[model samples]
Target: MASTHPEHLSGSTADYSVAVPKSMFPGLFVLGMVSWTLVEYLIHRFLFHMKPPSDSHYLIMLHFVMHGQHHKAPFDGSRLVFPPVPASLVIAFFYVFLRLILPEAVAGIVFAGGLLGYVFYDMTHYYLHFGSPHKGSYLYNMKAHHVKHHFEYQKSGFGISTKLWDYFFHTLIPEESHPKMQ
Candidate 1:
């Protein structure tokens, strides 16, 4: 039977009539991807890691449901990706929001780019937990940085697809300390 998941249906053909100019689409798409990296950084840092009150069981449970579980089980493959149901809702919201602020064609192209970026981020996060990348590679460095975020620097190192935001926000993990001259 055909899968009923939103992810399965997400590959439905787009309306090329609403597409941005061929030349501009690539630039706009890249801009959207870059914008997604910033959004990822902000949400991960500010929202996911926000500390709920000590006495509120409901808030604590909500925190666990949202993000604490990931920290609690960094290697859980099932929880790695945003579930398609909730993801679809967020995607729809962005689609409507973008359409409101931008031309339909431009918004579609940019939204497609942001969606692709989110896919990349989810896959990269899963791979960081499970796949072993070659040392000195980009994925290798990212995996190392992400591991530090999980285990050592929970308050920083929120960047996943890129470190640009962490650098911009001064939240990048610090290097190992070295002794200075006495």
Candidate 2:
């Protein structure tokens, strides 16, 4: 399966750090992870699910390559997580962006937290696609939500890791209807 090595991520982002005091790490880390959820939801909803111009073959192909392919073959494990190179490019972008906006120590820890959130998102996404969770559990619910998004609610239910964004954005997939039987 395509995956990012955490060691590489830590190594690359290390340059953006200067010596984050132990006291500030937890808060900065949590902030970063919280920031990531919004980013995840936004990217999934806007970019990955964007509809290209009908007349533009290039954009259409780009959409397919970026995300449609996942919907087309949901169970393809290798495609579930991004390969290291592309993932690193995006990660680096975040690191640099955060560095510009925040102190070095703060930015590094925040970036690391965001990166950890992303890893969790990827793992949760893969599990929702292929794992069996106990009925009524969080994963079970998320799996149902994700499958619905794939099969019937393409425009809603964009949150793969956590439903917090979906609830906030009001894009949640409505509850499934089941007809009553005598």
Q: Number of backbone collisions per candidate, in order?
A: 0, 0
Q: What is the lDDT for 136 in model 1?
A: 100
Residue 69 accuracy (lDDT) in model 1: 95
lDDT (Cα, tens digit) per residue for candidate 1, span 20-110: 5689989989988987898899889988999999999999999899999999998888879889998999889988998888877788889
**Deviation in Å, model 2, residue 126 alpha carbon:** 1.0
Name the regions of candidate 2 deviating beyond 4 angstroms. 1-22, 177-182
For residue 147, model 1's alpha carbon misses the true position, in angstroms, by 0.6
| Per-residue lDDT over 3-51 for candidate 2, one digit per residue giving the tens place of the 0 to 100 score | 5876556456665656766998999899989899999999999999998
Candidate 1 Cα misplacement greater than 4 A, ranges: 1-21, 177-182
Model 1: lDDT to the true structure: 0.89
TM-score of each: 0.84, 0.84
